[model samples]
Target: MPLPSIDWTAQQKAARQRSIAGGGKPGLTRMEQLAGKSGREVLEGMMSGELPYPPMNETMNMWLLGVDIGRAIFQGIPLPQHYNPLGTVHGGWFATLLDSALGCAVQSTLPAGRSYTTAELHVNIVRPASHRTGPLRAIGTVIHGGRQLATAEARVEDEKGQLYAHATATCFVFDVPMA
Candidate 1:
């Protein structure tokens, strides 16, 4: 299979920015020493060029935990209000985040004229996600590329690299002939 050409749409990025910015701020902060780039710029670099990490990488979420990437790092924190009536973080939260990460990883490496859908998904929830588990990170990678079907692997782990959950999926590719 040919290497994927990445293109993160402007509209998709704008929406993310709006979510982050929330309501309009009263004003701007003093240059903030290190002026940050818009999510779109960072994504553009990834799409047309390169980023320091994989797509769907939300290291920026670290602000919530007051941590930095690769330093005293915890894992992605459990989402708030993500609890089920059973008094535990809902499995759906894990599934949603995993699905997002998995799908985005594929999208990040996909070529135009082609699209993908989950043909099969198997998530093994070894441990429950706890709001107190510090932070968590879900990493996804491709395991196989086929003419009509592709396979991928994903893991949701805590800061200490302890696996909380693991999943493997088969993605159906369509609308484009294999090149």
Candidate 2:
């Protein structure tokens, strides 16, 4: 198998451009502002593109599609780009999607200045996925949220609702100082 072609010049330029652009919503500088809004509001901003979607979403071809207080849903397609050496969608891609959903589900429950990071993640792949799986959805819901920690669960499934993978995550909650 040959390595994918690369245009280092173009790739470098694109990387530079992305950095200067600031990955999230423009002109929103205060992390406290996020803590001030309900989880729904923040998720809404991401979905509406009022907030710039994370660059990773573009790289993975996945994006936040829906959210509520303690739940989030993401959609993606399994493309050749995600293929593993075995020619199936890599387990890491499934884990990434589930992690995003799980983390965001906890994020949706946070207050403006508050944030959480994945302290631990556990994923179980029940069925292999590939480009042939068509489009898929990852749905996450918060199982518990406390002052210092949050736990969420998520599952990845095809359009017809066949389960491919599922996961749970623990996040360490913290407050960021406002400037």
Candidate 3:
């Protein structure tokens, strides 16, 4: 089956507009400001510019587009700088996109005072992409959310929904340390 056409450029522009409208900027959120907020609340804060977005997103040319209780969506633009010697987008780029989505999906499932770190990640690239690939999206969804651990999976797909890569991640859930 064929996926529906998507205007990726327009989608990207719209998302950026919303981010700016909400005063979203790349930086760090102070621990104090995160106190007692559920994972979903923290993510929502970032989306709404009440908290800082991660600097890594800027570095990777990716942005978190949306989030829900156990899901996260991110978009990335592949540029020449992200290519490997073979003249294709590097696997690391795919891994980073998948990792970000997977981590965020798990994070979105946590309760207040809880956090997670990626304990394991595995990526499988099924196709190649280049700067010309336009915008690609990594959609992550939590498979299991537990007190001590969580698992999630993600897929990197083009605007037309062609799968480029897929990955799974396991995260260790823990309590945020007291200040």
| Model number with the top TM-score | 3
Show the lowest summed lDDT stretch of 10 residues, model 2.
1-10
- Per-model TM-score on C-alpha atoms: 0.57, 0.80, 0.92
State model 1's lDDT: 0.50
Clashing pairs in 1: 75-135, 75-136, 76-135, 76-136
Tens-place lDDT per residue, model 2, 1-179, is 11124442333334334434544443443464465676667767666544556767767767676678889877677789999999998988998999999998998898776778999999999998887777677889999999999999999977566899999999999986666
Worst 10 residues of 1 by lDDT: 64-73
RMSD of 2: 9.4
lDDT per residue for candidate 1 within 1-179, as digits (tens), equals 21123322233344334434553222221222113433223323333323332333352232111111111111245645667887777777676556645644554455445556888888888888667775565666667756677777778876466888877778887664334
The candidates, ranked best first by TM-score, are 3, 2, 1
- Model 3 agreement with the true structure over 97-124: per-residue lDDT tens digits: 9999999999898888999999999999
Clash counts per candidate, in order, are 4, 6, 0
Question: Quick one: ranking by lDDT, best first?
Answer: 3, 2, 1
